[model samples]
Target chain A: MSSIIISENDFLKFKEYFYRKTGMLFEDSKRYFVDKRLIERIEATESDNFRSYFNTLRFEASGDELQQLVNAMTVNETYFFREEYQFKCLVNSMLDEITHKKKDNSPIRIWSVPSASGEEPYSIAIYLLEHWSGIDKWDVEIMSSDIDTKIVAQAKRGHYSPRSVMNLSKPILDKYFIPQGGGYQICEDLRQAVEFSRVNIMEPADVRTFRNIDVIFCRNLLIYFDDTSRRQAAEMFFDSMKAGGFICLGHSESMSRISSLFRVRKFPEAIVYQKPLEAL
Target chain B: MAFIKKQTSQVINEDERKTPRDFNGLCVELNHEDSKVRRWAVRDLAEQLNASSVLVTRLEHEDDASVRTAILNALAKLGDTIAMNGLVACLRSEEAALRNEAIEILKELPYEVEPIIDGLLTDADSDVRIFAVNILESLRHQHVEQWLIGVIEKDPHVNVCSTALDLLSEVGSELAIPAIEKLKARFPDEPYVCFSADLALKRIEEGSR
Candidate 1:
């Protein structure tokens, strides 16, 4: 029951600032939703008004408040086959092109980062099994990483809440998962198929070992990083990739905003970025 | 299963990492014949506090775009006086890409860049002044609108004022309205300025209401 009111100008200020900091843009339709969250954060941070809260959000050295705001604003929940079109892109377009262009029969490598409890890497495995015909022909390496050790451990455990697996059809669920602790436990094969490691993508040492990657699913994570970190992340990925490798960002995130190193590649399933074939 | 595990333990062979890894070795490698070797040296150099001046020197001669990027990131990581001044020097470089790269790094270092921004704005080089305004375009400092107002109010170059005015359109407020109105009169013959200033003025008036 505080009397803090967000004026029209205040909302505009917050909207532009938030969009610039994080790539996520809130439309006019999300105004009520945005304002409510802003008020909640205002109250939580004990700021006198929107202006003070915004100042701290922008200038706070630790950047905890901005991170908190990103978490509150973004729907960060991950599930099986989330943004599955990119998987379709993988099976239909990316893998085919990769296998064809590859001179040697080296394993095609795929990296999924911010493993976020393994749904994505697991989903990639499941998608290749269910949809990709070349799964039988080519050797594929799937590596998944997360900044949080706890999340990395959780990802390796391969357990999922009911909500996490809600997108999976019952038949696929039955085939790939077992009921455990009133939740779904991913089968041993899928878990073993992926190599999960703890990695802070920002730390060069953590990511230096991930090299020659072919397709990278780095969705929904860069939106949380500040501008410099995002560019550095792009640079790290650029170095990690082989020439002509593909990168799939979150639907909202674009390499165009981050750096000019990658080329925009449009596929029927989803648009992706590519390290130019000529780049060393 | 076609899906393999633990297959990539980096492609870099242990024997290939034979470059001397100490600070002096990295400085020498920064001038190595291979661009990749030089890039790796830049990355490793970024970890050392004393490496900034060397990085600044290497960045001067590093022609490869990727190597330049690594050097820029390393300098930004150091975030010291030498690092900041080196980036400012890039702002005056004849190469457009180098200038743009410097702007990108400067935009992220508000605390480091804040002390130098006023001097940059008032610098004799109009293009350098324009680049300074470009840094202000995304600079998160609280005084961005004010700095931009100063440019529009005093910076004699039309293109520089016009650049400041363009950014002012997005971030300007009632405080900027007077300066922007005077800018329109100051550049009476400049059609683009008059139009955008009116547009910014209208938006501010509407937004404040």
Candidate 2:
């Protein structure tokens, strides 16, 4: 066992640095989470103490370690169809608009901005396959992205443990996923529906890569950001969407407080927004 | 079906058959010609069983609308983000009912819904637009304030504009005060906007006090 003891000052330093770099606000109460995750990092790195690990993180490297630090710090607790109503809205309302907006040969694009562990994007693939009959008529592309490279790699594998399939229905299980030795593998068709990549929501990137997206599903991940970061991230989503494109959020997320470019729509239990047909 | 039968002998008794594989055979029934079989299979597979590759594949190819809806519902119950892209594709179906069902599933996962909500706001269908607004209000989102203000400032539809005003009042933040002031200045004839502005101002004063 690595005898790495994290001090209060170390926790504070990480909190401040993480807040500054990633805009993830960690209060004093999160000392335990910080200490626990960093201790694991220290053990993995084979460092004897917290000071050496902290020093290496601070000085002996570029920003690569920062990502592992952030990954260790982040809580990636997510599951398939975690919120049922929102997916209903995506299939019911948003899909109709995309179908209406598409030209005969135009490819419909979708970006899952924080496509954690591939579940969200794969869920989307399952929805498309189940509902849309004229699949070959449209060129459909689903781009699933995340900031954590480790999670991105894991997501790309398209495999899940038995525990990970707890929420999945048997019919859906039998249809879209195949059983591997100890885990489940998403079917090739659903797996092929989306292309996964590593992306930081906060950093500047080639928006054109996500261009012409008819809809984007960036659910639940924004709560980790501060107000300014949220605003900036929302703007990025706005810029990335095509005219009259749609954005779907987590059940608890709303744009009412941050942006003016989108038109808010309501369903009984779901909320979706659309970019204006023209620029705001 | 074969896997389940082979594994059943490993179980000591019928009551002890709790593994996810017990429910594995339903995916074949999900696409059967009989609607009842398909529906039953979907229900059993989606609610009780672990995700199976075969079932997901069959449901993905099932031609019947009801069967498809059942499959989507089952996927939603599973909450697996892996199916998100497919669910998103389902949102583009020509049938309004099918599309609506897909949106309903997306609405349940707020964390996964935020980025997609912005795209949904500009949908040509008024009902879809309204659904986006309701979701935003529930999420207490700060990002939509600016867009809501713009809607109030210029949306051709009266209901859309009014909904924007209502949302601004509900948010009750100082950031909206400027937008409300502008609405009051430009849309002076619109009493609802004026009323909302006044109410927001009153709320701001009370908060400060």
Candidate 3:
């Protein structure tokens, strides 16, 4: 079988189908990425061009092929402490706000949407354990999710490469991780703190399940979205957060044009948004 | 000779002495007939003498856009006036990617490159204009604050307008107060315009306080 050459028409068809099915719009620039990912499917199925490969995906024997397609399409680059200042704010100021707003010893729920390989949610878990006292008394839950099943499986393993562990401070590393052969495995305590699941942010079921989250760390994921999709995602984020809860974004991402629901907060090195208590 | 030190190796030879000059000679091998050799030389030169006037002068005229981009980036990293004309010439390139990269480099320079950047504000490419606005915002070049305010007042792109508004709020220039107030008066229904204007007013008020 020869390698399939992806044409513009095939790219458009895939883009339109994906958008219609999942509400995740892919722009014209992602043509290269789509071509690269789908060629593997074409090679595996011994089909030429994206049209036959896409047909195989639609009518495959097992559902796993479609899952692989979604997995290939989803972008999942993340690291622990990806945005340092936002985490600092969470540790320093946002914790106080969360504590003040919650009833004494009530469970504080946090979600890391598109959690990738689980570095982000685990980072939050470590933060909570280190800073917040009476952790056992407070029913703390960290819900970590990603659209890719493979990454979700990896996330559940709670293992990481040395490079991924770079952002983790020495103290945190020593406290929360155990030395595995080459990479470190998250200690049982941190691993148990989060519930890992495969969840596409564009799926209605996934969004509905992530309700009443006290804080959301959905950073860096919005840049891929078009304007309408971004607005829809913003609305979903707004719905997900509890009253007075915070939403941390990537350093470059801003809610300025997309949503008025979030009130932007300025810290020295970071910007975040808060869903107003009054609005809630 | 002043920069070089005498080695105490017992096996001193003429070829070894000539090796330094050979490496220097390979600098011209950068222009060798082989594309691979020329490419490697260009990359090596870019890494070694990023801002050296001689390297910058030579590489700025390279046929390859990738090579020219590397040169522009190296020049920006050096932040010297010697590379300014080359950077300025790049801003007018037909390629949006090249022009955008040049604008990004100019924005990083400490000196006021606002006049050049401000000219790009009206470029047909929205990304170029947006990046130019971002650079001005980062620099807090108050001279261009009015230009930004004009963007907020009149630019068709909401993202550009919002970016300008956000920057103006951050800079908290008193001159922008009227523009913000005017935007508020005209676009009362648009939540972003109102929100940005209010934030700017709040910032100005807080500054006075």
Candidate 4:
């Protein structure tokens, strides 16, 4: 056990610095959680106290420690096929329509923004391969990105705990993953299918790197951002996609609240946003 | 398939089976003379478990524009790459609407359309090269600077080089200053290339500063 304590002023300093860096707002309700996570790092590094740790975070030349802190503080709760219906809609209708109009050999592109671990995008690959027989005939590019460099690195490792894959069917599990130690490691083929990178959606330059996306899966990420940052992210996605491209938010998130640029589309399985065909 | 866990002595059950879809009737409706029926059939096939093959085969011969669009959309939803060939061909379409539609799809497929766009960049038709440059302008990629610099240095078409310089003005860094200088040296006679190169050079210098 360690005896690291965080003062109120030091906590506020961390809050402000974190918000400035990642646009993730920490409210009063999350004080205990944030304080504890920060203290863990202070003790691990043998720092004097929270104030000194704050100084290191703010003035540090390298962003590596700050990223580790982000990995510690943020909640990366996700699983394969967490929202099966959204993927169902993706395979059932969206790809069909996009491929129908495509007469050339251009591939269809999908983005899983803040893809957390590799589960979501790997799930996407597995689902598409299983449900869509025409998958191999079309060039399909899947990009999975997250702001937390640690998590992105973990995603690239393609390892998952048992809980992260509970929602996956046994056949999918057996076919795509091999049990490793107590955890499961994704197969090489499925792992290679998704390209993983780090991106902060709040930053315009970062988001600008992703383009011409047909479908975007930004589930459960916006809820962590403030209203202003949320609006910026929505605008970024709107600008990043093609006219008539689809966006799937978390079950609790609504495009109506984020931005009015996207039209709400109701499918039999899920409700998503679409950049209208007329949109430039 | 059933797997028995030796340690736990438990048999993991396979997934619950789904009801089979009527792909045959949907296939028949796809060939209906009425474009409306064909369109509806295309949408219906998208709902089936394994109608992608039926949709891909029908898409090749479908004549009605509306039905063809429906089939394309359906095939896209099915995640078939067969529609890509047709969509790429549309980039060369003389019809403005068809060409615009194709560009829309191609623009959304940055990674997949790179090769096709590369082919167009050096096409004999300067208009095609301009179109390729315009598409590259909107896309975001790590190698965009490299591609733009290549065009500015080597492409003989002033319009294409100007387009590349315009994009460089937005995304370029100090690394692009030399490329802009080279463009200026390459086409001293072209006023627009020189002007755009000046603007790009200024932007890159200001950014680096």
> Against the true structure, whose lDDT is highest?
1
Give the per-residue lDDT of model 3 (tens digit) for A155-269: 9898999989998888988988888989999987666667877777766456655666778888867756643356557756765677688898765467754555578877664
Top DockQ model: 1
Clashing pairs in 3: none
Write the residue-wise lDDT of candidate 2 on B103-205 in tens digits. Answer: 6556445555566666666777655566566545434233555656656565555566567777666444566677667767877788876787787677554
TM-score of chain B of each: 0.94, 0.57, 0.58, 0.68
The whole-model lDDT of each prediction reads: 0.87, 0.64, 0.65, 0.70
Considering summed lDDT, which 10 consecutive residues are worst modelled in model 3 chain A?
A55-64
Ranked by lDDT, the better of candidates 3 and 4 is 4
For candidate 4, the per-residue lDDT at A34 reads: 94
DockQ of each: 0.45, 0.01, 0.01, 0.01
lDDT of 4 by residue, B44-157 (tens): 676665776777678557665545555555544454355555665555667664455445445445555556666777778877777777666434345566777777878988
lDDT score, candidate 4: 0.70
Model 4: DockQ score: 0.01
Compared to the true structure, candidate 4 yields what TM-score? 0.44
- Fnat, model 1, is 0.46
Model 1 Cα displacement at B90 (Å)?
2.4
| Per-model TM-score on C-alpha atoms | 0.90, 0.44, 0.43, 0.44
Each prediction's RMSD over C-alphas, in Å, is 2.8, 21.5, 26.8, 18.4
